[model samples]
Target chain A: MLEINNLHAKIEDKDILKGINLNVKAGEVHAIMGPNGSGKSTLASVIAGREDYEVSEGSILLNNEDLEELAPEERAHKGVFLSFQYPIEIPGVTVTNFIKTAINESRKANGLDELPAKEMLQKIREKAELLDIDRKFLSRSLNEGFSGGEKKRNEIFQMAMLEPKLSILDETDSGLDIDALKVVANGVNKLKSQDNAVVLITHYQRLLEYIVPDYVHVLHDGKIVKSGGKELALELEAKGYDWLK
Target chain B: MELKEKLVASFLAFENKVSVDTDSNVHDIRSNAFDHFEQHGFPSKKDEEWKYTSLKSILKHDYNVFPEGESAIEFATVKKYFLHEIDSYKIVFIDGVYSSFLSETSHDGYDICLLSAALKQPKYKTVVDHFFNTIAAKKSSITSLNTAFSKEGAYIHIPKSTVVPKPIQIIHFSTGNEAELLLQPRNLIVVGENSHVQIIERHQSLSGNVVLTNSVTEIFANKNSIIDYYKIQNDEKSASLIDNTYVQQKQHSHVSVNTFSFGGNLTRNNLEFFQEGEYIDSTLNGISIIGDKQLVDNHTLVMHKHPNCESHELYKGIYFDKSTGVFNGKVIVEKEAQKTNAFQQNNNILIDDGATINAKPQLEIFADDVKCSHGCTIGQLDSDALFYMRSRGIPKKEANGLLLYAFANDALEKIKIPELKTRITKLIAKKLGVDLGFDL
Candidate 1:
């Protein structure tokens, strides 16, 4: 479902991802684990087309379409989603309204009419139930004064709403407590289908216990130094990243 | 001749046109105000308060001091300017003349009428004489200019313990009767003890002609009274407005003034508040969204004179293209005003490289026990927030508009009327050049 060939990316003058390549097919989950400052988040950002990072060399293809020149929103319209580690707090924009706008904007980009209000509400209600979100919480401002767990859960709720083709979870489990991790993992697991893919970028192996990955890749410096399977996560957790370096 | 000299020379003709009794107190007040204007002319950039805003270009127009030939406008042409969804007491003026046909005044248990009638009639003379121009700055040159020509405007008076069911809408329209016109409107509102009132005022020009409005408003909130005043300055690019509003609050009174500036050539708002007794609450909020070569300046002041009084001020500006903005908020807590709590915040966003914002927050606190804080920020929109919204599938333009709307939302949250809030929200969305999909 996604392919990266020699993806050399840099932010300003500093090189982050140097000559890295990865591929993942539909119906599979991939985990990219690295220590602090190992370009794990940079890979996710580059895949999502964040403008701050420049892809100096090579290209990224999603479903055989080059995403080199696509903007973040264009990538989103093409069914790419990035769940941020620290969600932006937009006061005065209710979560439900934000989700509605996002869904409608995506629809509009695809030459479709806006979703009817009734259908939108039903979808929202269903998604809220799936994510265990309160109706009152949906009416509050988007992430304004939200707890860490609530923010991550809200991101998962949005991911469920959009149903994107490729979902990149960048450090989504960092600030979450055990209960929130379970809820977020459960939501992701239920939404997984044969036509979509999930990329989990994390610093620890705790999340893998809940949502097991089909493959595990340890990113060092910028390139992927090691590739293995689910048992590799437990091995790394036991030995720590110092042994990999 | 310079516009100042012409205005100075037109004072006698103005008085002659009004044909005021020479011995009346109103005549004396006008004469004294004219004298002050003649001495100071118009404020220059050399003055500390007028340092950032220049009036040289605006003051050069040969404005018609008094418009000739009465011009009547069809209500349909100007209906959108009013909050037409709800029933309101409207005091409308056209080219400095009271439009009785377009106005809906009242005298039942209260007075919601024109200032001219209150000045001439014997029944309202006492109320007019005591409160008119009492809180307005006597030494301000432009305010004095408005006072000198303050013959017609809105006059509202609520009796003690009376709550006005309907809001009062005071609208001023210019029909472009002259090549260049100058309008001075003076408003006096007195909310009696335990009374409440809400007012919405706007200055609009029908045609693309040069119009300069120098307006003055004085409001008195008696003991335990509440007042909410809204000023909507969304005139044409050829229109310029200088608004001077003064407010006086008695013990336990609450008063708030919200100024929304969306369009105009050059707009200056001078809003001040004076706390006369203890436990007074004052709020000053403003939002300015302008583009092109337009400029909006907001100068606000709050004086805490008695103990335990609280005041809050928040101003937000969104400038696009080559627009420029200025915000000067001053709060003073006197020594006798112990336990005073005052807060001020001014946030601005410059969308273009040519856009500019000058913000100054001045806090003078002589009371050591008081809590007075002020904050000011000027920058472009947060790129991180923008990227986040765009990543959610919203286009860049809509995301920018939404962020700007959210930045200005807190100030709009204080609108007491639902219809008015919706109208202002639509206005903001329109100003931001986005639909926002739904009412905020």
Candidate 2:
């Protein structure tokens, strides 16, 4: 469902993602394992179309359409979801409002009718129960003054709400504790489905035990250096990326 | 007369009768305000207050002042704009003229009358005339302009120790066909010793044409009394307004005033609070939501006249379009007013690039024991916050609208009146294109 060939990107004239290539099909989960300063985050950000970063060269195709031709919001509507590593704290904007706006925008883009509050509330409650998210979470400002773990859970909750076809979990395990990581992994597992895809980006292989990926691709210096089966993550866990370097 | 010429003529007309009793402690203030206005002469472009707002637009208007005539409003019409909701000793003024026949007031409960009529009433003559010219008497030109043509204004005297549950509502409806109008509305409110009262004065335009409202309200609070005053100015954007309110506080009295300005092309409000008695406290909180080329200038002065007085002032503005805002606040502590604790803060947010804000908070303390401070800030929507919302799949416009409304919540939270707060919140949402009725 997604294809990338020789993708190059830079932030503020500083090259981050050099030539990179990857391919993924429906019902597949690919893990990109990279050490620090390896352009792992930059790749996730570039694919999400963050304006601060520029694409120097390369092409990304999703559903056989040029992804570069779309705006960040357009990319989102195209089912390109980036679970932000560090979710932003928007003070004074409630979580319910933020999620509602996103849901409507996505529906509008997908040519579907907007869901009103009556049905929306019921859906949110059902999703919240499935994810074990508290109802009070809907009232607070969007990640404002939230704990690190709550933010990660909220990101997954948003993913659950959007029901994106392709979700990129960018370092979603970085700030989670063992318990929180379990909760996050459970949420991802519940959301997994065939005919869709999940790209799990991480530094440590510890997250692999909870939600195992179908393919493990070692991303070193902006390019995918190695690709293997799910056991490859456990192998990397046993022998860290430093040995690969 | 030419526009500038008429203003100069108006100020010229009031320059002579400006006087204060020498034995009274406030005589020097009277002299200062008189000399200030005399030299300034109705704030032309040369004055800072008149920089963005030009009175010349109204001066060139070749309209006659609406003479007092038959009132179009009934007691039921009066009930619409009333604040306290229930039975009020309602006072009505049409075209700045006191309507005697349409007004229903009773001395059995309190003292309410037209300032002109009270001047002739035997029992109320002393209290009525005591503050008539004392509030803004300093600007002989201003009082001269209003009083020289004083056809009508509300004069209230609350009896000692009487707590009025229902707020007295004063309604001014301008009804005339003239191309231009000039209204000199006035009010003299006296809260008797230890009494409590709330006064709401709502200004409306029936003509909805180019007009000018030059209004002044003078409030006097007796010892140990509390007075809550509210002013809502929603006039036609084409109209020009200049409202100057001078307030005096007695010993141990507390006075609070809230000004909500939503309309007018160029509106200037000068609110001066004097803490004359020991332990007196006063606070002035105001909010203005502006659009287009509207200019709202609020100049405030807090004077600590005696020892142990405390005052607090906060004035905020949310400016949209190419509108401009000016908030100049002064907190003055006299030498005798030792241990005075006064604070002032002015915060403004400009929604659009073309919008502008000018804020100056000043404090002059003559007493060493006084604690006085002031601060002002002009900030815009946070770019990082905006992008964060946008990244969540929210459209750029919808994201901006959310953040902008959040920027206004700080001011909306300060409105104490629940009904008014909800109304203002909805009004803000409607203006910012959050038509779904934002739940604040």
Candidate 3:
């Protein structure tokens, strides 16, 4: 469903992602694991069309369409969703309102009618129940003064709401406790389908235990140095990233 | 002659036409105010208080000091400007003349009538004598100018221990009857001890005519009274307004003033609060959103004369194009006013490179036991917040608008009136020129 061909991207004259290649078919969970400064997040951000990172070479293709020229929002319209490592705190915009705006804006771009309020509320209720988020949490400002675990859970909740074709979870388990990590992973697992794909970018193999990846790729020094089956995650977890370095 | 000289020259003829009891105290007050305005004329930019706001350019117009004739305005034509959501006491004026057809004045229990009626009637003579032009700033030439012509405006007087049944709305509409018009609306509100009142004031120009409003309002909140005052400054681009509002609070009284500036060519607001007793609370809040060459200047002063008094001030501005905004907030705590708590904050966002914001927060505290803090910030939109919103499938323009609305929402949260809050929310959205498909 998504293909990255020798992607070399840089930010402000400094190369971040260099000579990276990855391909994921439908319904596959791909885990990109690496230590800090390994460009794991950069690859995810580039695929999500973050404008700060210029594509010095190669292309990111979704359904054989090159996404180099599309905006971040355009890429989002084309079913690219990036769960930020640190979600932004948008004060005065309620979580429900923010998700509604995102959903309606995407629908508008796709020339679809706005989701009916009743149906939207029903979907929100179902998703919130799945994530175990309180109804009061939906009324508060988006990510303002939220706990770390709550922020990560809210990100996964947005993923559930958007139901994107390809979802990139960038450090989605960074700040989560054991229970929150389980809840987030459970939500992602429930949302998985044969028509969509999931890309997990993390520094640890801890999240891989919950949503087991079909393919594991070790990203090091701006390139995916190794690719293997799910056992590769257990091998890397048992042996530190220093061994690979 | 310039507008200042024309007003000075036309004062006598203007005074002679309106016959008042020469023996009354208001007569002498008017004469003294006229002399004060004549001496200072129009404030120059060199004046410290008027440094950022210059009346020199706006005063160049040939404004008619006395727009004598009344032009009829259909209530349906301008009904949207009113707080049509709820019932209100409306004192509406057209071309400086009271439009009874469009006004809903009250005299049942509390007095919600015209300032002219209060000044002329023997029944309301005591109120007129006690409160008329009493608390206005004498040093402000523009204020003195309003006091000199302080004849027609909304007069609201709530007796002791009474709550006004409905909020009063003072709206002045200029119908473009004259080539250039100058309107002076004088408002006097006296909320007695333990009384509560809310007032909303607005000035609108119906046509693209040069209209300048020099307005003065004096509010006296007696002991244990509560007052909520809102000023909506959204006028035609050809209209300019200089609003001078003075609020005097007694013991245990709370007064909040919220000014929402969304339109107008140039708007200068001089809001002052004077605390006379202990445990008084004064809140000053403002939100300004403007584009083009429009300019808005908000000058505020809170004087803490008694002990155990507190004042809070917050003003936020969002400027686009070449629009300019000025916020000058001053808090003064006297030596005897021990335990005074004063906080002032001014934050601004410049949407365009050409847009400008000059924010100055001044605090003068003589009391040793006082908690006084002031903060000011001038910045552009947060790039990180913008990208975060855009990354969520929202366009850049809508994202910026959403962030801007969020920035201003901190100030908007202080609106006590729900309907007014909704109206101002829509106004902010419209001012940002974005259709976020939802109300902020």
Candidate 4:
């Protein structure tokens, strides 16, 4: 469902993502393991259609629909979701209100009527239970004054509500404790289906044990140097990125 | 008297020729204010308050006293406005004159009347005289301008120890469309000892052309009484006006005023809060959104006359399309007013490069034991917050609108009236080009 051909991008005239290629079909989890400067986050940002990243070359397609020229929100409406490395603190915009807007915008793009408030609240209750997030957090401003783990869990809860076709978890486990990590991983794993895909972008191999990946690719210097099965991630966890380099 | 001759001949001739001429107070104080206005006329650019704005275009017009004509505020408009969100007493005014035909008040344990009629009452003359004596002294030419041309004013008196459940709603409308008109709408509210009441004063103009409105409001909160006044000035874009709000608080009394200046050409607001009693608390809040060449200037003063008084103020503004905005908030604590706590903040987001905001938060504290702070911030939209929302499925326009409304919520949320709250909500939505459904 996702394809990238020789994708090249830059920020401030410096190349970040040098000619790289990757493919992930539906019903699969891919783990892209890279060191600090291997363009792991840059790739995630470019795919999410962040305006600051300049795409110098190549085309990225979701189901063969051109994704580069679309605005960030338009891309998001097309079933693209990104869990930020650092969740933003959006003061005064309540979490429920934010989720409602997101869900309605996506529904409008799909030519569907927005769900009524009562129905939306009911759905939010179920999602919050599955994601292990307190209803109190949802009532406040979006991620305002929240702990790091709560922010990550809230992001996953949002993903569950929107039900995007492709989910990019960029450093979702970076700042989470082991307990919070398990809750977030459980929420993410519950969202897996036959027609959806998940790209787990993480530096540590511990998260891979919780949400096992079907394919593992060693990314170095903006290029995938090696490709293997789940065992490859375990191997790198033991030997580190030095082997790939 | 040559300048007076010019004013009476050219200006009063236009005032006499208006189609709808209402009764005006030709009293000594107003006549003296007019004499003072003849010397200063309108404030010039040399005046610190009028530095960013020029009333030259307004001065050039042969302005007359807009007379009281037929009102367009029928039952349908009131229902459309109040929305029955909360129970409220409605008082309507047209072209600076009271419209008793369209209004009804219970006078339930309260003193409420038109100043024109109240002046005739022997018992209420002392209060009227006190207000007339001190209002212009509370501010600058803006109050002087209002005092100079006040055609009509509203009065309300709540008895001691009573709490009015429903808020008193005042609607000031400029109905006639002859252009080059002037209106001075005045309001005087006195809450007796231990009484509490809320006041909502709304101003609007039916005509799209120019209307020069000089309005003044004097509020007196007696010992242990509380009065909350809100002013919504949605005048015509071409209208030039000066609005002055004066508040006097007694010992342990509470007073607060929130003014929303959303529409005006060259508008100025002067609010003065004098804490005359011990342990009194005062608050002044304002929000102004300006577009085009519109200018909205607000000057506020918080004076702690006695010890243990407190005052807090916050004003936010948004400017676009070369609009100019000014905010000057001053806090003064007397030498004996110990333990005085004063705070002031003024923030503005200039949406366009050409738009400018002159913000100053001043403090003059003579008390040795006092907590006084003031701050000002002028910047554009937060790009970080903008990108964060856009990263979600929210569109750019909707994102910007949400952020803008969030920036305004600090003041808008303070509005206690639900009907007025929702109306202002929809007004900001429309201004941001977003759809909130309940269109104003």
Candidate 5:
């Protein structure tokens, strides 16, 4: 469902993502693990079309469409979603309203009519129930004064609502307690299907136990040095990343 | 002749036209104000308060001090300017002349009528004599200019213990019958003890002619009274306004003034509040969004004369396409005013490189026990926030608009009137060039 060919990206003349290549088919879950400053987040941001990162030489494709020329919003319209590690706090926009706007804007770009208000509410209710989010919480401002777990859960709520073809969870497990992490992982596992893909980008192997991935890739010095199965996560966790270095 | 000299020469003719009784107090006040205007002429950029805002270009117009006559305007033509969605007492003017046909004034338990009537009527003379120009700045040259020609405007009086059922809307529409015109409107509001009132004022030019307005308003909030005043300055690019509003709060009184400046060639708002007794609360909030060389300057001052008083001030500006904005907030805590709490904040977003914002916060606390804090910020929108919103499927333009709206939402949230809030929300959305798709 997603393809990255010799992905070379940099930020402000400093190369962050060296030569790297990865491919994931639909319905498969992939986990990209690395230590600090290992370019795990940069890879996710580059796939989401963050303008700050320059793709020096590489190409990304989603469903056979070249995403190099598309804007972030256009790529989102084409079903690419990035759950930010640190969510922005928009003081005036309620979470429900933000998601509503996002959903309607995507629909508008795809030449679809706005969802009926009743249906939208029903979907919101269902999604909130799925994530165990309070109804009142949906009315509050987007991520303003929200706890870390609440922010991660809200991001998952958005992913569930949009139902994107490819979802990249960039450090969604960090800053979350065990209980909150379980909720987020459970939601992601339930949302997985044959027509979609999930890419987990994390620094630790703790999340791998909850939402197990079909393939594991260790990113080091801006390159994917190793690729293996789910057992490789336990091996790496027990021995630590220093052994690979 | 220069505009100042012409105004000086036209004073005699203006006095003759009004035909004021020279022996009365009103005549004395007008002549004295005229003398002050003549002495100071127009403030130059050399003055510290006027340093950022220059009146040189605006004063060059050879304006007709008084319009020829009442140019009748249809309600259909100017209906959009009013908050027509709800019931309101409207005092509308056309070409500096009161339009009785378009106005709805009341005298039921309270007075909501024209200033001309209040100045001339024997029954209202006592109230008018006591409150008229009592709180306005005596040294402000432009304020004095408005006082010199203060003949007709809105006059509202809420009786003691009475709460006004509807808001009073004072709108001045310049018909542009002359090539260049100048209007001076004087408003007087007196809220009696324990009474409450809400007022909304706007200055609009009907045609694309050069129009300059010098407006002055004086409000008195009696003991335990409450007042909410809103100023809407969204006029044509050929229009400019100089608004001077002074408010006096008695013991236990609460007053708030919200100014929304969206469009104009140049707009300057001088708002001042004076706490006369203890436990007075004053709030000053403003939102200005301008582009294309438009300028909006807000100069505000709050003086705490008694102990246990509080003042809150917030002003936000969004400038784009070479627009200029200025915010100068001054808070003074007198030596006798102990335990005073005063806070001031000004935040600005300049959308273009050419857009400029000059913000200054001046706080003077003579009392040792008082708490005063002030902050100012001027920057562009957060690029990370922009990317965050864009990645959520909202386009870049919409994302920018949303962020700007949120930045200005703090002041907008203070609007008490629901319909007016919705209207202003729509206006801000329109100003930001986004639909927003729903009511904020």
Candidate 6:
């Protein structure tokens, strides 16, 4: 579902992702773990086509299509979703309206009609219920004055609504409590199917216990140096990452 | 002749055309006001209050002091300018003359009629004498000019303990019949003890003819009365407006003024409030969204003379292209006005490199125990927020529009009338050139 060919990326002349390669198939969950400043978040930003990073010499392919020339919105239209580590607060825009605009813009890019109001409302209610979000919360400004747990749950709610082909969860578990962690994990599991993929980027092994991963890749100094199964995460948590380094 | 000279010369002719009693007190007031205006011609840029705004170029035109012949305008042609969703008492002026056909006045419980009628009728003579040009700024040359030529405008009087059922709308439309025109409209409103009223005012020009309007309004809120006044300045690019509004509040009266400026060549709003009694509340809120070399300036003042009063002021501006804006809010708390709470805030966003805004807050507090605070902010749109919206598949332009709308939302939230708030929101969206899909 997603491929990175020796992704050589840098920001402001500082090389962050150097000679990294990875591949994930549909219906599978992949976990990328790394220590501080190990380029985990940089990799996610590069895949989402953030303009500040320069892809020195590499390619990011989704369904075998080159994404270098497309703008961020174009990539978003092509079913590439990035759950930001620190979501921005957009004042005066309700969460429901934001989601509606996003869905309609994507559909418009793909030459589809706008979703009818009733169906849109129904889908919003269904997805909101799936994430256990309050009805009043949807009417509030998007991420404005929201708690960390509420923000994470709102992100999961958006992911459910969009149903993207490839979803990258960048540090989704950092601010969640145990209850919020289970809720977000359950939401991701329900949305998982044979036609899509999920990539979890985490600093600890705690989130993996709820979602579980088919494959685990340890990134160090801009390269994936280790690959194992779910047990690898537990072993790393017990022994720390210094031994591997 | 220059516009200033023509106005000074035409004051007598304009006065002769009015049917009011020549020996009345309003006539003396007009004479004194004309003298004041004659002494100080149009304000020069050297004046402190006129420092940021220059009227030299706009006054170069040979404006017709009085509207020539009345041009017939259809209701359908100007219907869009009105708040047509609900029933309203409309006092509409076409080419500086009251259009009886377009007006819906009432004398049932209160008086919502024309100033010309009130000036002539014996029943309304007392109201005309007491409130006409009573609280106007005597030193402002532009205000004096409006007072000297004051004849056509709305006259509203809410009796004691009475409430007007419908909102009042005062609209002035310039027919563009002359090459260059000058219009001066004067309005008076008096809310008796424990009364309430809401007013909406607008000035529109139909064509590309050069139109300069100098309008003045005086309002008196008696004890425990409530007043909500809204000014919508969205005119053609060829139109320029200088609006001076004076408000006086008695004990426990609450008054709010909201100004929304969307389009015009040059617009200056001078709003002043005077608190005469104790425990009064005053609110001043404004929003300006303009682009393409347009200019909008808001100058406001609040005077706290009594004790235990509060005042709040907030103004927001969004400038695009070469557009420019200015916000100058002055608040004063007298020595005896203890326990006064005053707050002022001004926020602006410059959308383009060429856009500019000048925000200044002036506060004078004489009472030591009072609370007075003011703040100002001027910045560009948040790039982080833009990126967030763009990542959600919204285009860059649409994202910018949404962010701008968001920045102005706090001020829009204070509007009490829901329909007017919706209309203003739509106007902001339209000014930003995008559909935000929801009312903020």
DockQ of each: 0.86, 0.38, 0.76, 0.50, 0.83, 0.69
Runs in model 5 deviating more than 4 A are B21-23
DockQ value of candidate 3: 0.76
**C-alpha lDDT of residue B80 in model 5:** 95
Cα lDDT of model 6 by residue, B1-440, tens digit = 87777887888887888766865688888889999989999998799898888888889998988885877789998989999988999999988988888989998889898887888888887888777887999999889888887777899999999888779999999988988989999999999999999999999999999999999999999999999999999999999999999999999999999999999999999999999999999999999999998999999999999899999999999999999998989999999999999999999999899998988899999999999999999999887777777777887888888889889998998887888888998999899999886545
- TM-score (C-alpha) between model 5 and the true structure: 0.98
Q: In model 6, which regions exceed 4 Å deviation?
A: A220-225, B438-440
Off by over 4 Å in 1: B21-23
Model 3 bad stretches (over 4 Å): none
> Looking at model 1 chain B, which ten-residue stretch has the lowest summed lDDT?
B16-25
Give the local distance difference test score of model 4: 0.80
Which of the predicted structures, 2 or 6, would earn the higher lDDT when compared with the native? 6
Clashing pairs in 4: none
CA lDDT of each prediction against the hidden true structure: 0.93, 0.77, 0.91, 0.80, 0.93, 0.91
Which residue ranges in model 4 land beyond 4 Å of their true spot? A116-118, A218-228, A231-245, B1-28, B66-73, B77-84, B366-368, B436-440
For model 2, chain A alone compared with the true chain A gives a TM-score of 0.96
What's the best-to-worst order under DockQ? 1, 5, 3, 6, 4, 2
Across A1-245, the per-residue lDDT of candidate 6 in tens digits comes to 89999999999999999988989999999999989999999998888888889999889999999999988888889988888888888878899999998899899899999999899999999999999999999999999999999988888899899889999999999999999999999999999999999999999999999998999999998889899998999988999899888
Q: In model 2, how large is the Cα lDDT of residue B213? A: 78
Candidate 5, CAPRI quality class derived from DockQ = high
Candidate 6 lDDT at B186 equals 92
Clashes of each: 0, 0, 0, 0, 0, 0
Indicate the docking level reached by candidate 1. Answer: high
Residue-level lDDT of model 1, residues B311-413, one tens digit each, is 9999999999999999999898999999999999999999999999988899998988988888999989999999999999999999999999999999999
- Please, what are the lDDT tens digits per residue for candidate 4 over residues B1-440? 33234454444544344322123233666657656766666567898766766777776766655464555556665454442577777677777767786555656677666766666556666677666547445236556656655546777878889998888888776765556667777777888899999888777777686687777888888999988888877667877778777888899998889888888788888788877879998989898988898899898888887888888798999998899998988888889999998889898999988998988778887889989888899988887677667767888888888888888878887787777777887877877777632122
Model 1, residue A67: displacement in angstroms? 0.2
Give residue B163's lDDT in candidate 1 (0 to 100). 95
Model 5 local distance difference test score:
0.93
